[model samples]
Target: MVQKIGAQYLAKRFADQLMASPEPREEPEEVVRETTEVSGDLDGQIFHDEEGQPIGRAYLVRQVEVYVVSPTRAGAREELVRCLNEPDSRVYLREVDGRLSGVVYTPDPARTGERTGAMRADDV
Candidate 1:
């Protein structure tokens, strides 16, 4: 039987990818939010298809929101945007048994509706 998954699990998955990267040094300042939880019903399916065969499926049991900002770097948000754009710079998901679950990428802040005005907190 398939075991159930949760938001916290997906959050950790997102966090792990950020930490294990070379460019983005692992910092404790990262944050994760439980954006949404989607069940794998008939209408709910995430997969990649090549030709007529199915390459893999992403069991999106949960949708996790992540925020990573580093004070050491200038325009850290832009850096993240570039990193996430690279195909190699991706976050892959794994099941409890350590099997390849899916690949995830940090969404662009502008597209994801996370970015607001350019004014910094200290500028306020």
Candidate 2:
């Protein structure tokens, strides 16, 4: 139901999904290779710890598999996910220049079960 987000992802179009590993897990060679091989969705993210060291699962965006390391979320990540489930609220992971960038919080468009204007036009 990705299209429920108002966009289609080919239903079966392959997208990479990574798992969140504990901060102590460190980066594995296989995990590193997997992230570098494909770029798409990531179930987890990689960020640097307070000590200026990398933590979490490293992932990539659209293509090229360019590595981009981000900083720690300072405990905000869990909160973001929780609030996304609230009424009319949406949380998005923003990517820029094919790297993990920041997060975007916005109000979701209310779904009325009616076709959008573009759909109506196509029906006419």
TM-score of each: 0.23, 0.20
Q: Cα RMSD (Å) per model? A: 23.1, 24.3
- Which stretches of candidate 1 lie above 4 Å from their native place? 1-46, 49-53, 61-64, 70-81, 87-124
The candidate that wins on TM-score is 1
Per-residue CA lDDT of model 1 for 4-119, tens digit only, reads 46777777899998887567568778687654334545233545566666555555434343343433357667756765775545454545556554444444444445443487
lDDT of 2 by residue, 1-124 (tens): 6566444453324332234444575656664333343334443567678997878786553432222121235645554554467586565666778776665654344432342444566687
Task: At residue 72, give the lDDT of candidate 1.
Answer: 38
- Cα deviation of 102, candidate 2, in Å: 1.0
In Å, residue 81's CA in model 2 sits off its true spot by 10
lDDT: worst 10-residue window of model 1: 63-72
